[model samples]
Target chain A: MCAMTSAQRVFTTLSHQEPDRVPLALNLVLRGARELGLSIRDYFSDPANVVEAQLRLQQRFRSDVLFGFFHAALEYEAWGGEVVFTEDGPPNSGAPVLGSHQPLSSLRLPELAASKGLLKVLQAIEAMKARVGDEVPILGVAVSPYSLPVLQLGFDRYIELLLGDRAEFWTLMEQNIAFCQSWANAQLAAGASAIVYFDPLASPTLVPRSLYQDTGFQVAQRTFAGLKGPTVTLLASGRSLGVLDDLAATGTLGVGVSCDEDLAQIKAACRGRLCVIGNLNGLAMVDWSPAEAERQVKAALAQAGPGGGFILCDTHGEIPWWVPDDTLMALGEAVQTWGRYPLVGAEAHA
Target chain B: MEARTLRFEAALLSMDRVLCRSLLQEAMGEERQLEGIEHLLGPALAHIGDRWEAGELALTQVYMGGRICEDLLADLCPTSSTPVAGGPRIGVGVLLDQHQLGKRIVASSLRSCGFQVLDYGQGLEPLELARLARKDQVPILMVSVLMLNSALRLRELREALGEGPERPRLVVGGAPFRFNPRLWQEVGADAVGQTGVDAVAIAQRLLEESCAP
Candidate 1:
């Protein structure tokens, strides 16, 4: 078989067919800033820097996917939500938008065209699409409306409102889904291959299976129904074993699995239905030896690589800022050597 | 196995704060808020924590339960303005990661249990945390983290905080430690809490040990 381009490899893998190798979508965000000798604030200050850094990273690692996501707070920030950006990690919410003093019903939905942070993300996606064209897949991210409350109202408060006030909760969900659809569709229109439907709250790790079924699942079903393009529902390193069936039912093309889950079981469960994107421990990756990195990569490949429906990626979707550059190099190298089609370790998984 | 404890647990799981507060008031009889926390609320929260660990309960239950209890403590004991005398000075903060929900719950639980917990804020560096500990003269500092990288940084935090009889007892908690049972010790913590309720017990025991003559 001829060697495939990154886009071909990813699309083929999503179709459950073995390409030249498993596609890699390293969720490098702050790491990109570090590569260019720029502070995180400076790196994200201009959308051009985000594009340049991502292109440089793709060139250096020779990975399959390009991420157009910067941070989750950007979505909330677009709606006048206060966000704080630091040197070490991605930006985080500064304060709760729906505090007791500021009720959800009283708030007005901000216009999408006026959102600076979100527009910057769309601009980055457009630039990357202009640069890479169809040769590589660019992955965009849209926080699930069901879970965006965690970023908007704070996790603790969101849980209270979710469980205590059903009326207000659904009202918040209605507003969020509208914003989420617009944001996700804009990314797709901007030339992204797919948007990651980032929804950590739906994971059984955060909420009970019963509650998720009643709330997050239904909300996700509605949210996914309106999206114009394909999406991969990401649980952000949260355990998804208990909710795999529900995740498969969310109309997503793929589901990002946590490192804590059994990869083979996940593959068997999603077989012929949804592409399994990950299970690599981003946390452990910080301290991995090159040999250890290879071993871990092979183990994951052995577990889910046989069916050709897996995309190798970090569990949390985004790689940590503190993870050494050498470690990422080792991971890329390991994938190149062992991730080829007709994988030697297929028997172990089969 | 008391009926009130079980009922209180159920109320918290259901997030019925009115019923929860009434149950606590009934269970308390005429005792103080600390007594209710010790005899009723503590055990109920612990049972909820166990259920959560066993996958029988949701994280929302645990979190809301803590928040509800914090509010109840404020309402029930409106004049309990200070920490119990002779207790070890306690402080709480999130390490590197900005996820501060866990820290807030722990701090509130500790405060409800009559410990004056100094809030050191979130995303604090090791040096900044150490400086805060020194400036505040806090003896027992509880640190929470959601990410593994942040959890591992406890070693650097421990070093910066120093090693001596006077150094604060580092208490660690959060998802990573819960995932890896032995991670707390590996990260140089003196103790680890499985939940906000567990933080109360751990703080009490640490204080007892510190005050030993």
Candidate 2:
């Protein structure tokens, strides 16, 4: 059989079929900034800079899927919330726009396409597609409604709304769902292979499991249903089986797991239902020795690689800013070495 | 483990400050206010910290509990003091991190422990923290960095504080510290706290040790 392309491998994995190897990818930020030797502010400004940095990264390391985080810090800015930009990391929201006396019912949705930050993200996606073409899968990201309320209503007020004014919270969830659908559709149309509904705030770490499921998960169900093709749900942390069943029911093609989670349980939850594409502690792996990194890759492949639906990847799909280039390349080396299909037919691919 | 503590936790969980304040006032009555704060409410908030680690409590709820505890502490004590003039009047803040709730909780917990905590809130530059510490002549500087990016600034913060013998003692706690026990130590923080309550205890001890002749 011919060597499958990255998009081919991902699509095959998404279809729950065996591919050339377990698809490998990274969740990256600031790498583009580093490539151009520019501040994050300067690097993230132009679609060309993001594409150039990603292309340079591809030249050094082999990633089966290319992920651009242009959408990561945009939701708050797009929603008219003030964001503080740093040279080192993504933009941070200052305060939530909504408050008491300003009723939730009085709010009007901002035009996501018209928002410069989101428009820049779409521009980056289009530029990535124009340059990379069909060989690699370019994954876009959409912030979930569960995570957006933190910017829209602020944390303190949002919590009160969750417990005291749940009816209004649900209405906000509906609005968030609409927002995500619009954003996801725009990115998909702009040439993204997949757009993961990224929920950094819906994690059990941030909210009660019951509350997350009741409020966040409900919004995610609708949000995921309306997104374009081959999408998945990327939880900031997926350390339990609580939301997997409902997550599989979200109509997403895959589920992104984390290292804190039991891989066996994730495979059990996702196998025959949805694609499973993570578990390696991506952030900490860079600090691990090459031998240990390779060992982990082999271990993940051995455990989760049995089924066809598994696409091996780092947790949450993000590579932290401090990771060294050599360490990242080492991960790719591990993937290329140990990520072969049919343990018996390893020699055939080799 | 008392029934009142459980009821108090329940009141906090409801997110109704009015009902929670009423229940807390009724529980404290007039005499046992300090005991209620340190023993009952303090331990309860610490328990909520454990729940946060176990993914049971929300960030918002924790913030609410912290605010309520702080208010109750103010109502009970009415007057407090730190390490006199040039002593360890501690300065605490969230360092370039978006999540301020944890630091706020830790600050409130320290106040409940009878320390005069000047909380600078969230997204503060490490240099800003150092400048404030120097100007205020604070002896203990506690920082909460819940994210990786925020934790990365600790060395810079240490540099800003300078290595003088009279410089403030540095302490840290948050999600990043929990990830690596030696994270704060690597960043030059003198100490690390496992929880908000633990941070208070640690900060107090660090302050006392610094003030020891």
Candidate 3:
């Protein structure tokens, strides 16, 4: 077989065709900053730095995906909300901007072109596209309209609003869906291959399936339907197997699963419908031995490598900056060694 | 389960707060306020927690149940400063992450069960948390972390607090620890709570163990 470029490998896998090996997509967001010897806050402050760091990281980690995300808080930051970045972990939105006192009526969607921080992210995506072209796939991220309220209103408050007042919840969703469509379409226009529709709150782990069916599931369906490019709905909230049908019904090309789920089961469920992209325990990766990393990669390959719809990735959307370099290196090396199509030692492990 | 408890659990799971409040009133009519919570509300939530663990119930169910129970307890049962006299001092806080839903639920659940808890608040660094726990003389500290980086800091916290009879027994819970079952032990925590209900049970057992010696 001819050697495939990272883009080819990912596209091939998404098409359910055998790539040379399972594509590696280490969700290195903050880790990109770490590679550049800059603070997460400093690295993300400049679009040029974000581009340079991500390209350098792709060179180092050899991941198939170039992340076009800084933090979810950036989405809210564009709405005149504040974001607080720390030395460790992703930034969090400061003191939620929406609640009973403030209300959704007080806010209006900011023009994506005018929002400096979001414009910078789009600029980074455009720059990354120019540099890599179609040789590698750059992924843009947008929090789903159903789940974006977690940033605007805190989790508890959001849940309260969602369950308590249908009118306010739908009104809030209308505003968020508009921003989400605009933001996602802008990224697609900037040359991202697909938008990762991050909807953690949609996961059954967080909300009841019946409630999700009534709220988030329908919102995701509408949001994904409006996106200009391919999308992958990521439920990082855990145990998303129950919603495979609903996620597929959202018209996404793939789903980013959680660590607590079974890869083989998810792959089987996604067969012929959606590509399965994850389940690696990002938390456990912080302390994984090289041997353990290899074992996990082999097991994942064994379970899901039979088909071409699997991309190896961390369960959580973003790999924590503190995960050891050696562990990530081991994960990459193991995929290269054991993840070849017509998978070796697959059955023994399976 | 008894008919009243089952009906109450159903009301809680459905997020019918009004129904839950009415049920609690009915239970209070039959028993003392504390007894109603301990026997009725506590068992209902624990059942929901167990079902969540067994993959039969959603976390939202547990969360809403806890919130409703907290609201009911607050209104129906006036909070006494010394709900349980000489109860082991339990401290709860979220380390490094600002997500407070898990901590809020666990803290409320603990209080519902009549345990005295000192909520040190969220975004506490390891050393700062250690200092606060020590100063408060917290015997059992339950820390919640929404991210793995924060969970890993439990090692630093354990080291700072040190190991001794007087040292607070670390009880860890939240997303990371819940995802990885053995992570609590790995991070030097004495135990891990899979859910807020589990935290209540773990705290009670830890308190009983402490009181034994």
Candidate ranking (DockQ, best to worst): 3, 1, 2
Which stretches in model 2 have alpha-carbon errors above 4 Å? Answer: A95-108, A238-240, A343-350, B1-7, B14-32, B55-61, B71-89, B163-166, B194-197, B211-213
Candidate 1: residue B113 Cα off by (Å): 4.9
Model 1 C-alpha RMSD to native: 3.4
Q: Residues A45-128, candidate 3, lDDT per residue (tens digit)?
A: 899998888888777877889998889989988877788777788887765666547866887888998898999989999999
| Tens-digit per-residue lDDT, A1-350, candidate 2 | 58998889888878888788888877665677888898888887887888888877865777777775564657778777777777666566775566446778766787975799888888888888988799888888888888777677766667768777888888888888898889888888888898887775566656667777777777877777777666787776544456667677667777777676778777877888888878777547646777677677777777677757988777756776776777777778877777767744332322
lDDT of 1 at A235: 90
Model 3 residue pairs with clashes: none
TM-score preference between candidates 1 and 3, better one: 3
Give the per-residue Cα lDDT of candidate 2 at B122.
Answer: 74
RMSD score of candidate 3 (Å): 2.5
Candidate with the greatest TM-score versus the true structure: 3
lDDT rank order: 3, 1, 2
Question: Candidate 2: deviation at residue A323, Å?
Answer: 0.4
What are the per-model DockQ values?
A: 0.39, 0.36, 0.58
In model 2, the Cα lDDT at residue A150 comes to: 68
Q: Write the per-residue lDDT of candidate 1 for residues B12-47, one digit (tens) a residue.
A: 877788898888787667666457667787777777
Regions more than 4 Å wrong, model 1 = A98-100, A346-350, B1-11, B16-40, B50-56, B71-89, B95-98, B111-136, B146-163, B175-189
Spell out the clash pairs found in candidate 2: A27-A317, A27-A318, A27-A319
